[model samples]
Target: MNNEISDDNSDMIISDSDSNSEESIEDLNWIQTFLEKPGNQIFVEIHMQYLTDRFNLVGLNKYCSEKMSTMLKLMTDDIDFLRGEYSSMSSIEKRMLDKECAKLYGLIHARYILTYQGQYDMMTLYSENIFGKCPRSACTGTPLLPMGLYDVPEQDSFKLYCPCCEDVYRPAHITQGLELFSGFNGSVLSEYKRYQQAFDYPVEKHLTLRDSELPLGKNLDSEGDDLNIINQVLKFNPNIDGAYFGTTFPHFFLMQYPNVVSGEEKPKQRFIPAIYNFDLHYNSQILRYQELKRQQLEEKLSKEYDPKLIKTKSKKIFTSKTKMYT
Candidate 1:
């Protein structure tokens, strides 16, 4: 087994004369030029050996046709991997090889972003709002993350994930359509930690409840109903942290004020919404409220209507209709 592995590695090494060949030199020039591109500099540190390995490129052959015979050779300029006569190929043929080479790089990029360094780089981009920001007013322009709809290449385009709304949206940037897509076989990568970090901005400017508005020691007679309503909404995600309440359950505040209070009075720190949190639109909120009331009324009426009585009445109506038809 060791002997076989050594032979394979030795075969992958190109002779000095082969390295100086026209095709080999051209491959070298292409690689150098590609790495120098502004958008491709991130891949410079990622070695060609890993990128061209058969194990890492299991399903990428489907994207490349037979015209580009030696994919490994095109990428690494290694003579041992060469099978085709790239030196004799026409200009159009060389262009096809370049395109295939780029596709391979994209496949490698999908793998790269899953690495620690890649994630760090992507996190930096996330902070800079390079991917683009959520357009929903509730999200307050929180930076979006690129996520593949399907792990398979060319299966689906990428979507923008909003940590604030905890939802996905079609990206606004046209060029971003060809962006990051996962090549991982199983589950897609999780950005839960990223979401937590990106969503920590203060939201006091958007939502603030004065001590007077809080139901803690306020007039129980007037604020009692309001407290009950708040408690009911809170029940939707009982285990949710106060800071992320709006992410789980959307709401909005018409008025805003700083929660800070002066010397003798300590600020009553209630659970204020996060800046990168979802706030339902006012009109939609109204519709939802009416829908909830309608559901409650139906539930109340349902208890009075016996299922057995309804079934009996349906059977009698069926019998009358059948007799008339006969």
Candidate 2:
């Protein structure tokens, strides 16, 4: 089965490359350039929406919080161990301790993903407070020109840069924190500079398969096509990165798999929307938005509306007053 799967994947890649090769270079170039744009607002909006999507936001927050807690626990364990071993350590062992400390710093530097219902909105607020606008300025003379969507650091709320002018800026509080963390030592600053260089790189793009080619089920039709299942497996398998599949004779046959339930029936691959749509993070965001809206509406009505106005008729009261005056 493994041999068959490998052959199928190889064939698929070849077929995709051959088919996609005919695609216009101009279109590809435009896409690449658009992605390259600093502070590409559209991409930022899309990312914000994806982060704050009803199902993904909650899941992401929970996942991040749990990871943070786990990391803290591990750090505590490491510190305890280090304290026990510190006094008797030789020079080589002390060097190992330095390596351990560096590892800890790296772990701390790992990007933290925070999901919020109003992530896009929050980004705007942060931009307004720090850089004056969320959109990158097109003016070459403007300091904001260099600041793009990618310039925004994950987890850090205060640090920002102008992509156009290559100017770095941070909120006062954030600067204070950075000062405390660095203790005027150049090591943290050097690490941050390296991180910025890495963070500026383009996001990796993955090959997306169409619905018809997605393999998610265990059923085949009369003609016997297992291409969908093969494709789905390939998509989920992170190991297949930078690999291509070919579409030749024996390679096509690699997609055909025997049905386990009833040997006589070939199972067709079915698309599963549930797998992709089941983002816990997004669902939590939707719930949070609903709650927020509800609260806002309630507050508005309570403060702005008069209950007495509903009970009394202005026209009838005016008529009564007129009669008394007459």
Number of the top-ranking candidate, with TM-score as the measure = 1
162 Cα displacement, candidate 2 (Å): 4.5
- Alpha carbon lDDT of each predicted model: 0.43, 0.30
Worst 10 residues of 1 by lDDT: 248-257
Candidate 1 lDDT score at position 188: 14
Model 2 lDDT tens row, 1-326: 22122433322221222222234433322223322322221122224234223443232223232333333322333444333444355655443333332222222222111223223333442333322221223322221211212211121222234333334443111111121223333442343343234334232222122323447752223222333222222222211211011112111122231121132222222222345567466666776676688679867776556666644657678889999999
Tell me model 2's lDDT, rounded to 2 decimals.
0.30
Report the lDDT tens digits of candidate 1 across residue range 281-317: 6755776676688679767777648797789888999
Please give each candidate's TM-score.
Answer: 0.41, 0.18
Could you give me the TM-score of model 2 versus the true structure?
A: 0.18
CA displacement after TM-score superposition, residue 52 of candidate 2 (Å): 26
